[model samples]
Target: MHEISVAAALMRRVLAEKEARKLERISQIVLQIGPMSGIMPDALQFAYDSLREGTQLEGTELVIHSAELTTCCRHCLHLFDSRLMHTRCPRCGSEELQIMGGDEFFIQYLVTEKV
Candidate 1:
């Protein structure tokens, strides 16, 4: 699964941050994952758990926050957010839409132990 690679990359960034900040221990990692990001949270968590074994992040908690899908109607220029997928704009019923958000995969923040 590609989640392994994703997890590996995330781990690399986390390690870099830890080293850069000279952190003693990382307690948690908060992630913002969009519904349309094509990332399975369970699979990503499993991959992260497997990859962190025997590493500095072994016990680090992985927290995932599901982001809402936001879209704008091309015809009406109306913006709306939803957890479900929509083919048309709710305001104008136009098929033409611009996706404003809900296709993201990024680290939001990290919780670390203090010295």
Candidate 2:
């Protein structure tokens, strides 16, 4: 699945960083996936399992920091949170909006052995 590939890519980067820092193993991985990132955590977890096999982070915990769609109203200059792709501003009910956040998926932090 797509999540599998994403997990694989993530693990690759983490492994590279771990080696550079002389870390022996990973205890946990914290990830942030925005609302619009379109990546499911369940699928990602499954993928992580496969990708982590035989790696230093084989049994590491995966923690996700969820993000929601945050938009700023163009007309009222109000900031609001949403779970929609496109919707009227909640504060002023305006259609004119500028997306301020969401659309992100990346590793935030890693906890690992010092060496």
Candidates in order have lDDT scores of 0.92, 0.84
Query: What TM-score, to 2 decimals, does candidate 1 have?
Result: 0.83
- Tell me the spans in candidate 1 whose CA falls farther than 4 Å from its real position: none
Q: Weakest 10 consecutive residues, lDDT, candidate 2?
A: 82-91
Q: TM-scores of the models, in the given order?
A: 0.83, 0.82
Backbone collisions counted per model: 0, 0
Candidate achieving the largest lDDT: 1
Model 2 Cα displacement at 5 (Å)?
1.2
lDDT of 1 at 93: 96
Range of the 10 consecutive residues with the lowest summed lDDT in candidate 1: 82-91
Candidate 2 lDDT, 48-90, residue by residue in tens = 9777888778878888888888889999999878777667877
**Cα error, candidate 1, residue 113 (Å):** 1.5
